[model samples]
Target chain A: MKISEKLARETLLEMQRRMLRIRLFDERASKMVKRGYIPGTVHTSIGQEAQVVGACMALKSGDHMTGNHRSHGHPIGMGSPLGPLMAELVGKATGVCKGKGGSLHLADYAVGSLGESGITGSSIPIAVGAGLSAQVLGEDRVALTFFGDGTANQGVLYESMNLASAYKLPVIFLCENNFYALSTPSHTVTGGRIVDRAAGFGMPGVRVDDGQDVMAVYDAVAEAVDRARRGEGPSLVEVMTYRFREHSEGLRINVDYRNSEEKQFWTARDPIVLFREALIAAGIATAAEMDAIEAEIAQEVEDCASFALESPDPEPSVAFEHLFTDAYDLEDVL
Target chain B: MSVMTYIGAIGAAQQEAMSADPRVIIIGEDVEANVYGTTGGGKQRAEQGDFVQQFGKNRIRNTPISEEAIVGTAIGAAMTGLRPIVDLSYSSFLYMAMDQFVNQAAKNRYMFGGQSSIPVVFRSAMFYGLNTGAHHSDRPYPMFMNVPGLKIMAPASAYDAKGLLRSAIDSDDPVLTFEAVPLWGAKEEVPDEEYRIPFGVARTRREGCDVTVVGVSGSLPLALQAAEDMAARGVSCEVIDPRTLVPLDTGTIVRSVLKTGRLVIAEPAHRTCGAAAEIAAVVADKAQHALVAPIKRVCALNMQVPFSPALEAQIYPTRERIVAAIEAVCADQLNAENRRVG
Candidate 1:
């Protein structure tokens, strides 16, 4: 049975909503950091939200996902509480990682948002292992890894791709090629097209127009996910996107390398606008309904921000806790 | 009782653990059949009905030439409830997978606020004598010893190798199981029944009222060999092996030093920030009042280990060097030193 057009459109719109939530949360928090509201560098996925959401929708409820440092969308897309995610950005106690891990270090284990790694491509092997776990555990679950163009160059990425392919592991390595990797362009760092390298590992790979349409990314993800379920192998999908903001809260992205007009081009192809336009065209959701959805999300973010602020800071004694498993006999340490 | 070389002892332990526990899995480059380049050919020697023979392709996996993924997968699998004894063809290759070892495996459980247990054993052949060159021969013990959550085990003889490997296999935390190149060929008689050499236990090889000698990993045998030579001159020496590094057996070594008053630290790695320096500091900190003389440390120079046999032999901390250091510390004195137990 084919997926209904209305369902696809709604999914696409939901994807846009998750993406926008991450963008605005990071955008506001980044301003806060500059104004002495927060302390710490922020790696925001401002321009690449659509791919994360589109790919996340391709996964089932129990399916797993891993992310790179620039992953605030992983938990939200995987069905985590948006308030905690936003609160985490605001450095509140109610944050997803309890404010311990900021933008770069978010994890929602309940939703199987496995983790995000600060180290480039480190999560590839972990995601492969998670996929292997799903297979071994007979869960028929899939694991998705969202890394940047820079992480694609890492040896672990190739290793992960090869191993996942060899065992036919239910793993998908999605490379969000948003041009510059922390000021270094993808072309300058990677030897060739990111997916071209993935091909060397015998896995099917493709270059998708990430900013063109959410439907484009969703279609690619669905096929790749079906292939994984069929026990075929892994796929490296290089989604070409852009970073509208700086690499972190402090650094500037639109500079000598990329034209400012490129930002305007991506914004014009904005995923929310694309999905909203598609929904309107399909007569699935009206303009007023979409406005209501946006208001609901905004209100949700606001409530969560307040809840996070009210939660007490983790006590200092909590630091000594969780050093080891309960099996650790530290009666002597005291 | 089966007689095997030190390297063979580790192989037997791996084989036994795999046979007893179906959950135990092996994944590394060329681990399936004819696992070439181990001190001995483990793949060729695998017995019938063994893990490699019985489980065949699915359970016992041989991966592509990727250490980072091999370790990372093992760590992941281990966390998800599987005992994975992953291999890094050589210790030098460990540098390629530092993130998995140090960041993921070492700190994962603690960083997760103790919500998980990383029960993985990372087995790698370490040290150099076959002239495999600098990249292959260099001993980076400092890297492993400094990692907070890692338990490092370097077995010297076949007896310790079998016992320590068994202990490491059963351990809940991650263990860095390293076998030195020189001791891989050293054979000994090991008991057939299962036995365990607990972590943080220091075993004495020789006892004396003269000087306390401490060596770790494969360096213990070298210290014992030097002690044997010192026995010729009627200079009694105490030799101790602190089996595990992270949860160091400071009690045993401290008592020995207090009894002997003089201490000698012999380590295969360089002199800088080594097991020797850590041990010396512990002795000075804990038993400084008992010291009759300053501690003497015998180790390789600060330079990298070269490939050439001559240069390699010159750079390594040798039994002769230990003897020379012992001579300097003893300084022709029947003199006041303590008697420690073997």
Candidate 2:
């Protein structure tokens, strides 16, 4: 069945709600990073909220997903609560990963967000593994991983694609191509087209050009996820999106790599605003309903940030914890 | 009792692990064809059936020459549910997937605050003495030993190969087995019954009193030969084989050093930051007052392994080198000032 045929009004509104959650959460995270609350650096999916929510909301809660460094919006899109994620960014004991992974390596397995990697293409194959697990265990679950246009150049992506295809594993390789990779234009480094490379691996490839349309991305990914659950093998979905903020927050590279015209073009196509307009026009939600959703998410982000700030820091003994499954005492080993 | 070669024993252990647990699977380059001969291709092939014939294609899988995906797939499968044994044909090729092996597999459990344990086995062989050139002839276990989230096993004999491989497969965390190509054909009597050698426990190959000789992985035979030669003369030597490097059995070595009052560490890897260097540091730190003479190390010369047979021979630590290091450390009158005066 087509996603549009069975798409409920509640589901459409939920999609926009998730997009709003990502928007306000990432915006709050940006302010907190500038205020020296979040340590190191944070890569936000601020402008790419539609690309994150559309693909994430297409799957069931039990289906697995992995992401790259720009992964704050992924778990929120998958319906994870904001408190643990915000606490993770603040390196508190209440964090999803207990203050060990920080922003770059957040993993909330409770929601089947396997983990996220700081490496560009490292987590792609891990999603393939999850797909392999689903196939081996005879489960109807599928696994999806989100990477970037820059990570598309990584050799591991092709390796993982080929492995998933050859084994007919239920996996989806989602490339969130936001045009730039840390100030370097992706086209400068990338070859012909990422979606076209799927032909070499004998898998179906779909290019979602208007990734700003939440329904468009959701339709494409839902089809692939359906095919994967049917044991029809993997597919590649490259969503054309753009980042509104810099590649990472709080770090100054001081390069005018992105021209003002192109910046204005993508910024004008804000995914949240576009989705909000689409929902209201289609009569799925009212202007007042969208406003209430936005207000609710804004309040949610504030409460999550406050909870993160008030959460206690992990004890020093935690440094030696979680290194192994069995007993390991640093004092005895030393 | 059954006599088996080192490679055969490793295959046997994997076969047993696969039969015992349905979750265990093998995936790598040409694994279905048994290209490297470490995973499977044994007499049991006809008896219990081969990998593909027994468990079918899903359990025993073959992949393209993609080391990164091979390891990453193993990590992912291990994290979710299955126990995957990934064979990256050679230790040198492991460098191609170090990001997955080190960054993903080794750091996954720790970085995720122990949310999941990665029960994956990564098998790679060091084909040094076979003259596979610089790219293929790498003893890279020392490099992985430095990584904290991994369990490393370097088995020197057929018995050890079978037992350690079993233990590695049973381990919850990610484990790496670095097999030596030269020892693949070495045949020895292995127990037909199941057995497992615990990690962090040293095996005494030879016992003596004058000097303690620590052999690592592929250097065990050389240490044994050197100890025999030393015994022919008047020097008594004790040889300790540290089966696992990460959880190194420092207590055994420190006790041996305290008794013998002299130490010598031999390893096939490079001298700098090698397993021998770590073992030497442990002994020096633990039994400093018990030492009658300074510790000496017999290690490969710090350089890229050359292709030429003669040059490669000169770089590796030989039996003669081990004997010489033992003799120097166990000298009758070992005072540095007295030796300089003489």
Candidate 3:
């Protein structure tokens, strides 16, 4: 189904807004890491913004999501506030996890971005659990989890799929096949097609070739989300995308794992530029409106960085706090 | 008070918890059929008794033989809202889901700045008395004790089993309860009324002054027997059981050591870096001045649990080993006093 048939012009523009926001936010985050403004390395989703934005756009506010290490774009796309998210990246007290969970562990439960996992294929079962929670509680909220091509080989992912299928859970397993699991080419490592593996587990698996097109990702994920919400069980949507930057910040720049030709091909299909052109070509938005959106997003990203910088560092004494719930009553037990 | 076996207490705990809180659910391999009989062994076991018929398959769910997925699902479900009580048939299979139990379930709360709580119970039957070979016979609670943000409970008696399981279900953090396979059929007087044994509280099974004996999990019964035998021989051994290992009752143990002036730790796990080692370190670090003799640890040898019943019996801590350790500690104290007087 075409996205234009279901969504209005404003919704299409908003999708572009989220994509641009992720792009600019990632760019600034990369610069901050380079300048030593951010303490730890940040995994920027620069080239893969459309997949995150598109998938998040298809879900309701109460729908749950779990992300991986390279997932700053996910919570941002799920409508998390820029200030706290940025604050968390900079280890500020005002951050979403109070600065305890920096870049890799960012979580905003209010927006149903359950949390991001540092372990590959770890969040898949977590997403299944969220789906189970919705099912057991008699809610229509579906759960979505984003993993990488590298995580396809993880045994736990298969186990999660089997459980989700057996229980008919409302979950969307979105695999972002960026051709590499870190430096290892996915083809050399992964045995069979990931989509086919989903079919083995009794779920529909679809491959979306246009990772650069936001509407394509939105439509594919929207279908999966609808099936899950309808209690039709889980579906796997593989969005083929690429990472323009190194695997992470501070990696060897001259690595030859990915050839120049491959890099150039994906670079030419930058999701933001492609989606912007699609919007203009479809006569849904003017060039001036596109320019205005970019300017607003740039300002929004700048404000996020400023707020993150101005936020206070967590108190040194509070480091031991939150290890367990206050109701634990360790003192009384002793 | 109602009489219940160790396994019966476990089933009662599951039934009461699920009845009291609808959010509590069970997921594991063979939970529907009770193949391993972990819920209870026999015709009227908990899994056999109308749980699937009443709670439906959604709540009392069964899964494929995937340890990682079972634990991962429980962790995820716990984080969202449900209190999942997942079983991993035997303690040896826990190695398959170490990443989920250690890295994910244990560290999620601390890593996420306490924004999420993994209120999941990973229940496993532990020990080596069944001659199930090395793979099936394991008491690996010490490995979990090293992980922060995880509460480890090893209940020895039927009464403590029910009470502690209930407490674990009510706890907001992730808890791993290791039930001794040998103690499953051991019966005791458990009250019908609801009760919960708080974590980190050491229970004094017997009081004495000559030597302090501390046992963990299945080793507690051996220590109690040794204490009785030593009492008949006029040794006056004091027995203490530190129910939960993470928030260990160091104060209670240290006080016991100060009063007795000697300590002996009995455990079923490997001697090196086992629960006994941790308890020994705590007593040595805190109550060293009060100790008149060197601390003794009666634990299994640092090797795999053998399949042969004789070999397994030789390896694990026994009542004779506990008695010998107590006698040696008492003898050393006397020698030290005599040497100082001379």
Candidate 4:
């Protein structure tokens, strides 16, 4: 089923809006990281916008999600404001997590994002846990976790799938197979199709071959999310997508891993541009309205960057804070 | 008061906590079957039968031998709601889930800037003296003590087992309870009324004037026996057990050392950077001027725990070694006094 048939025109436009938010925000973040605004490195969801926004938009606001190192997009897709996320990337006091998590770890509990992890395949089971909580508490909320194809081969994924299926948990194991894990091509390391592994665990596995199509990715994830909310079980949705930029901004991996032709092919199918054109072609939005959305997001991205840069650094005392619920001095405890 | 084994007290605590809060649930390998003798093999389980039958399948959930998922799921659940008691069975197998345990459970609250508290309990038994072999036999509490966000509990008696377990369940932060395998069968008097032992409080087992000896986890018995032996040998030795390692009661140990003027730390874990080392360091830092003699430590040798019982026994600290260390520390003060007189 097409999302356009069921979803409101505004919601469809919002999907494009969020996708654009991810694109422009990440694009701005990329430039900022290179310019020494963001500390460490930032993994931007530049090319894989549709896969991120589509899966995230499928769930209700109360539904939970966990992400990997490519962190900022999941929360943005879940409708988190751009300011705190950008502020967090800059290590500011007003940042989400109060600058403790930084860029690699971003958690906005206000929007039900449990948190993202730097370690691949680590946060996968955490989403399963959110599903477990919902079931035990008799809540209708479902949980979805995002991981890369590189993390697909991790044993924890199989362990998590087996547990979720055994308990009939309300969870969606969304594999963002962006074709590579850093410089290593996933095909070189991954033996079988990632979606096929779901069959072994007695769950339906759906692969969205055209992950660049936001609606296609949405239809698959929305169905999975529906099944999860109805208490059927967990489902594995592998979205075949690509990363337009390098693995991480400011990372100098000298290896010429991705060829120019392959890069151009993915660059042409940019999820944001594709969704914008689709919206205009369907008469859901006029070119001027689409232009206004892009302009609005561009302004939002600028405001976020300015807010992050102008924000104050966290107090030095915050380093010892939040270590435990009780504010015992670290010196005394040690 | 009633007589109960250490492991039995743990079971009582679990049943009590579950009864008190519906949010409390159990998840791990063989928790329903009570294979490791943690959940069932006691007076409580004998009366209640299978936990699955008592709490139903939803509350008493079992999982495949997936330690990583088991730990990670508990962290996620804890963050949202529901206090999970994850039975990892053996402390040695904790390595399989270290990423979730150390990276997620321990750091989640702090990493997220106090946005959420991970109120999960990871229960694992130390199997060092059970001849479980090198792979299984390990007192890994010292390693977890080094981690910041985690609260570590080592209950030496049936009373403490019940009380501390209750505290761990009630705590908002993530706590790891390391149950000593050797102490599981040992019986002690536990109060009939419910009680909770606060973390960072050191329990003074015996009072003395000559030296302060700190015993960690399973090694508490050795220190107590050594203290008794020292009493017979005309040496007064005070023994302290820091129940929770992370929120260590440095105040108690420092005060004890100030009164005694000497300190000796004993632990079942390896000698280097073991619990003993941390306790000794705390005493040295806090009460260095009061110390009349150097602090000595009695710990297992830094090596892979051998499969042979005899070889393993040789590596771990013994009552005799504890006594010897006390004697040497006491005599060292005398030598210092004699040298000053000359």
Candidate number of the best DockQ: 4
Encode model 2's per-residue lDDT on B1-342: one tens digit a residue: 999999999999988898899999998888887778854548867676667887888888888888889889889989899999988878898998889988898888888888989999999888988877999999989898888888889989999999998989999988898898888999999999999998778899999998999998889988999999987776788999998886788889999999999999998999999999998888888899999999999998998888988778878889999988987886673344346657
TM-score of each: 0.90, 0.96, 0.96, 0.97
Clashing pairs in 1: B259-B338, B260-B338
- Per-residue C-alpha lDDT of model 1 across residues A109-205, encoded as one tens digit per residue: 7787767878878777888887777666566788899988887778788788888988989888898888877777778866767778866888889
The segments of candidate 3 whose C-alpha lies over 4 angstroms from its true place after superposition are: A1-3, A327-334, B38-48, B332-342
Give DockQ: model 2: 0.80
Report the TM-score of candidate 1, chain B only.
Answer: 0.93
Candidate 2 Cα deviation (angstroms), residue A273:
2.1
User: How would you class the docking of model 2?
Assistant: high
- Name the lDDT value of residue B309 in candidate 1: 72
- TM-score, prediction 1: 0.90
Find the 10 residues in a row with the least total lDDT in model 2 chain A: A1-10
Per-prediction interface RMSD? 2.2, 0.7, 1.1, 0.7
Task: Write the candidate numbers in order of decreasing lDDT.
Answer: 4, 2, 3, 1
| Tens-digit per-residue lDDT, A103-178, candidate 3 | 9998898899988988888888889989988888787799999999999899989999999999999999999989
Q: Mind giving the per-residue lDDT tens digits that candidate 2 earns over A86-113?
A: 9999999999889999889989898989
TM-score of chain B of each: 0.93, 0.95, 0.94, 0.95
Off by over 4 Å in 1: A1-17, A86-95, A135-139, A188-192, A210-212, A252-256, A317-334, B36-50, B231-235, B308-311, B335-342
lDDT of candidate 3?
0.88
lDDT of 4 by residue, B77-195 (tens): 99888999999889988999999988999888888888989999999998887677899988888788778889999988888889999999999999998988888888998889889
Each model's lDDT comes to 0.76, 0.88, 0.88, 0.89
